[model samples]
Target chain A: MTHNPTIVVGIKQVPDDDEVRIDPDTGRLDRSSAPAVLNSPDRNALEAALGVRDDVGGQVIAMTMGPPPAADVLKEAVAMGCDDGVLISDIAFGGSDTWPTSLTLARTAEYLDADIVVCGEETTDSSTGQVPPGIAAHRGWAQLTYVEELEPLPEANQLAARRDVEGGYERVVADLPVVVAVAFGENEPRPAGLHRKIYAENEFEPVTVDANDLDIDEETVGLEASPTNVGGMETIEGVDRERTVVDDVDELAEAIRSTEVFA
Target chain B: MTDIDPSEYSDVWVFVEDHDGDVMSVSWELLNEAKTLVEETGEELVALVIGEDVDGVVEEAIARGADRVLVADDGVFEPYRADPYGEQFRAMVEERKPSIVLIGGTHTGRDFAGRVAVPTHAGLTADCTEIDVAEDGVLQARRPAFGGNVLATIICEEHRPQMATIRPGVFEAAPPENDRDGEIERVDVVVEEADTLTEVLERSTGETADVTEADRIVAAGGGIDGDLEPIRRLADALGAEIAASRHAVDEGWVDGSRQIGQTGKTVRPELYVAVGISGAVQHLEGMNDSEVVVAINNDPNAPIFDHADYGIVGDLFEVCPELADALEGAEQPEVTL
Candidate 1:
């Protein structure tokens, strides 16, 4: 409806996979032990949002909800040329499943009056990939999932997307005010911009929205409102097969021919 | 947890994906799986088929394992959309309350699952590898996270109809027995266009190879150089579908449609050849069910060897060209899904 599109990207900070350790007692990630880093896929969401803004003028708002340390990712997003950043943080928002998580995000989208909300396909910690669609359903908006590439047509208030589906690729379109789930590696995330970084450090202070800031229904804004619970957790590993490497190409070829897989 | 009684729910239900009378294989697989969950919980097995002319799906579900089949045949259900499809389940869930609902983890099914979860306040788990009944009668849904590094077991402790979209290939479809007796109920469903937000512009889905259904797959990973011609040639020679690990997909060496890993498709092909694959736990999780696996890598200690039945430690640049030459004009086996 405006001259410039309003793109909102929901980013998250997750435990670095390599440095993560599972707490055997609680069967949950030891976040304190593992340093927090941006959820890798969120880069694509930011990239998609920035790309749209670049093609047609727009404001990119990067948002996240976590502890104070999570502010680093919003800074990184700002460094990457987002027009602004917002962090939704509070102790009451911890331990949220997709339900409450989306409630918080949906309210933020409303608070920002975002025309489009972009999200990573899944988070490394939960890997549920439900929050995006949950937000769309709660907001009564269109949703596109696993979108590899998307472009907003400003005049028509429509967005066309290339979606990766079960058996093949599909071209779909949704009206504005839709939620899009961008898969990892959709586009190369641009390196942090020099001007944006200067702005992030000197002139920019991220707007923090807590429970008191928005019209959050207390009954549906915290972990207490989530429908799912972690009953238990266990580590799963692949079975190890014995190794016998062939020395030469000829031997490898011979082995391949005789192998049951080929037969 | 809420004070809701577990007795309020009565059966284990599955969403049967019936597109113009053609039932997707995964729905049948889920029906078979729901049979197992029903046994553990001592509940009835039911199947929900929504679409016009889906009588074949309903009958087949009854034959396979469903004690009851709810069929919603309406013209509005012709095109599958999340909002309408979600409402069909939400209305039924409100009336007939099933303890658990299983769906195939397809893009359409998962999006629909998410919408339904909100309306019914059901806890939804996507891409679940396994599911069962807990000792306390709660649904135990387990899924791999962080590239298969850990398994998280989740439960809908406060919700009804603990829902999960099970990975398609985890369970085999049960053989249908026409003689099996079952009950069928016809549902009345109506939808307003305003209730749905989006429509598919152009659907080009049937052409691409669904790696999950490919009997033989040749997968490439990060160890492979930018050149994928060699791997493509090898796959062509063997009449196998091409699959890629996350690394290969991320590197643009292959398409993500065929990626095999925790974040991609879970495959159970009969023969899998991993060329230049280091076998990240994520990659291994997708194809560990293959009947046989052959690994070709230069690194002797590459993690792929741990899951491969045959290991060949050699430079793929040399081995691939040589292997291509050796197998040149060789007979390509005929495989079927």
Candidate 2:
């Protein structure tokens, strides 16, 4: 039997932004106590990858690079139907920006011989949406971004995608080894199967791969190699308006009735 | 470590993008921003155009703001393949380095800008809403982060040609200054036949409402309680465009193009009426620049009132109809938004 297509889905563990609070004294996000959750859109990416596998009888691989605690998201992805999960974690990869992050993911996809790679359009924390394009650039592979729909043609070694652009959406067909960036709320994320969920939490211990596991040079994949620096953050304060309450519709109507805007 | 001396980089460059001979508006907006910026830095602003027979775009770029226009006209540039386009700009960036490079955050812009940034390592920032030069001469890009909960200003001080993808409608576009003098330089495009590139098969375009240009907007939000006709009636009565918050759009009550928020569109309409909108931070990021804002909601503490010029705390269903009638009968009231 021929080997099945290997689709590697990239996921991220970001701070639960809803639970995040600002350190009013420092004017910075207090992520220290916040819990980490699988990025919302990333779940859609995983669902897309798994859906492809369901149709083509292939395997879906969940991959992520973060601290040790990040392995939890991998477990969640595996529980969601991925056949395997790989976590690339190391102190050397710390402080890496999108460029180096893309390098690391590209190398992992290369080693895995991925036929297709998928990622959320952006992360909630950084929300740059550059890593996927960076990966496509680093790998010199065709990149389909902001994809809302995916059609897997396993026999043809191509994936047809419907992506959004300026005025409208277009259907694009790209050769295999392509990177697909899924748009937010593209698909309804499926629930993890009951059988998978039974063993997902207990049986999953992601295969950990450190920097040495790959052939990439250390100099090219760390903070030192990153070009952009987070210099400072200035908050864009929301507007504070007068909370006026008009007793009757006529009073409010009369008040706004003479304004040049509506009349 | 090899460092690029700040002194070597001289000009502010913008990618002049044209798709199927239709020039993108973001290019003009960026050129306007560049014009304002270059005046501050005393640097020449250049527009780099890549396409075949792009003489019209060349003249347009010059009229817009560019002190100089560089055109790379060749057959390979047709239909826009990523490899050749990215390499051509990368080569130019490496040869005649600029202090800053602004690319429109369009479909093609994101594709090539991301690729162009790799080897150049230009410290690319995506979806930047604001770009400016810091006191230290570094390019500062301010963008939304943490799901629009906060804004972060990023700096790429060490890299030459600090690159950024600017979302459209974030900056206002002005008409071309025809009286200005500018020069056009032609450059040959180099494409490798051996490189594999994705080809476009069939192309089609669809029209969406442009709320950014709407002088008056009547936007609905989740507070409408599924009855949009009242708001629609008000919008019809006022001859205003209908816009919505992300909530209404996501809830399938309106088209996504009409959504006004950080993730949607950045708009600065003349008059904006927010009905049933709770005034989320994300929604405010898009239309906070409106000349006048009026919010109507039953909840007095709704955040929408914070930015509104006038607030009416009452049920929208009851208030919208009355306001529509009052507006229709006020003959010759010097109507404006």
Candidate 3:
């Protein structure tokens, strides 16, 4: 491995989950109800990458695949101390599921000769922590998912991470060039610095790449190639609650005591 | 990508996850769910068990409902590395070509399902809460998206082996029948340690109780103001496990294991007590199945009241301790009885 490894962090712009709403009548998503923001966990991934770069002397590049406005997340990443940003956007890439999404990201990683690829555990909208592993599978690289702590051993060209497993956690060491899915809420992402934010806002322009530039086969890189399809969507109706409002703490306690849960 | 003919697929395979020779309950739950799908599709229900010393797990899987069991017992599979386990599973999938593959949406399942799916060109859906077989034999996988507000039904029309990871606790496990008979076939493990790139160095199990298995839970939220003493007292009085929402966990007021929400564990307890927790849709997704929900919050307009069977508008600091004392006093007669 080179002394100065290149680390690429995958960023995504997702609708604010807290504010997103579903139209009661149409049973469809009202995306306009929520403003777009950088996916929360992705910031943790970028933080992990920035930490690794600081520890081992590497360049952190933020990459995102979305519409044109998606580049804003890259700018946010730059303001957070990333060296560069790449936007892989194209009409063909739209509607691509995790399979093609990861493939396209893998192609971009390879193009940049990234020594490590970092991503969030999952997105808020889809919440499928598959892209990181999918990227590793596409490149046949080792991966660490649900990673809570990351340690870079540049001397050995390996990255060690503590990953969350069912019932427990395990520390795993993988060779450098590993893909890492940083666990949500693992670390507090640092706020963007003032000078960096100014530069990112006023002067920064992410290098844009399309499907054509990545040598992507039109038949294999878009919705036509994506296997999963949304057959239909149904708005979940809220269950009718008894709505028994108790006046005081004692009354609340008596109400709970009267329930079958005590028995 | 190789052209796939969906007609070539036949059986429904459920990947049975093993935790130290004990089969996870979700695997059994998936088996029970798969039985219905197979019944509808006229396909065999197969269980794929991959781990070392999983003979007991294989028998249990058969008794629970599997028509056939495929075993890949190997030392390399003990620690559950994605590369080897995924490679082995991918090999079996390629050779057998099951129509529908159901995996438990555990950390391990989500980690490797894509690894196998991407290589095989199979369509994989993640964390499906509902699944059924379409008339044409396609698997309809429905999952809550955008924080559980809308449920989307997904399908793979052209994929040979449709894949989905079902969230645990969404389905009930069928009672096991020891007398039930099923075919058990051993699969060859071709993956070697040298072929794997990652190595597990250390592991530590959590000491916290599993909230998902708790019959009754007393969970606190951001309104707790970083103090859990009152909630703990209430939980003790109610004899329930203590849990928290994502806000409490993120604020370091509680352990992450005790967090219940979209990104956290899904719990279906019989009784859930929410103290100072505003019910966000994300939080509701995790606890919606609770048989009885009680909310105590200062804000009357808090969304938690909408989902609560009983609501008390008051300060938790004052309400929790008084409720604890009252419940303790009420339980005195039961002890005498």
The most accurate candidate by lDDT is: 3
For model 2, how does the per-residue alpha-carbon lDDT over A1-263 read when each residue is reduced to its tens digit?
01378999999999887788878897766887889999888988998888888778778899999988898999899888999999998788988988889989998988888888999977877767788878888887888887888888766778888876655667777877889889887788889888898787877778888788867778877888788877767777765544455666666556555565544
What is the per-residue lDDT of model 1 for residues A1-263, given as tens digits with 9 covering 90 to 100? Answer: 35488889999998887787668796665767888899999999999999989888879999999888789999999999898999999888887888888888988998999988999988987777888888888887888888989977778788889887655567777877899999777789999989888888888888999977977766665678887877776766556654566677666567667766556
| Full-model lDDT, candidate 1 | 0.81
Ranked candidates, highest TM-score first = 3, 2, 1
Query: Any runs in candidate 1 off by more than 4 Å, and if so which?
Result: A21-33, A254-263, B1-4, B18-22, B208-210, B213-215, B223-227, B236-239, B250-257, B299-301, B324-337
C-alpha lDDT (0 to 100) for residue A58 of candidate 1: 77
DockQ per candidate: 0.58, 0.54, 0.69
Model 2, B210-230: lDDT tens digits are 787788789999999778998
Error of 3 at A132 (Å): 0.8
Which ranges of candidate 2 are over 4 A from the true structure? A1-3, A24-28, A258-263, B1-6, B75-81, B147-150, B192-194, B222-231, B249-256, B297-302, B312-322, B330-337
lDDT of 1 by residue, B18-126 (tens): 6557566778888988887888878889888898788788889899899998988877676576767877777898888888999887666777788788767788887
- Candidate 3 per-residue C-alpha lDDT over A49-144 given as tens digits, one digit per residue, 9 for 90 to 100: 999988879799999999999999999999999999999999998889998999999999999999999999999878989899999999889999
Interface RMSD of each: 2.8, 3.0, 2.1
Higher-ranked by lDDT: 2 or 3:
3
Residue B171, model 3: Cα distance from true site in angstroms: 0.8
Candidate 3 clashing pairs? Answer: none
Clashes of each: 1, 1, 0
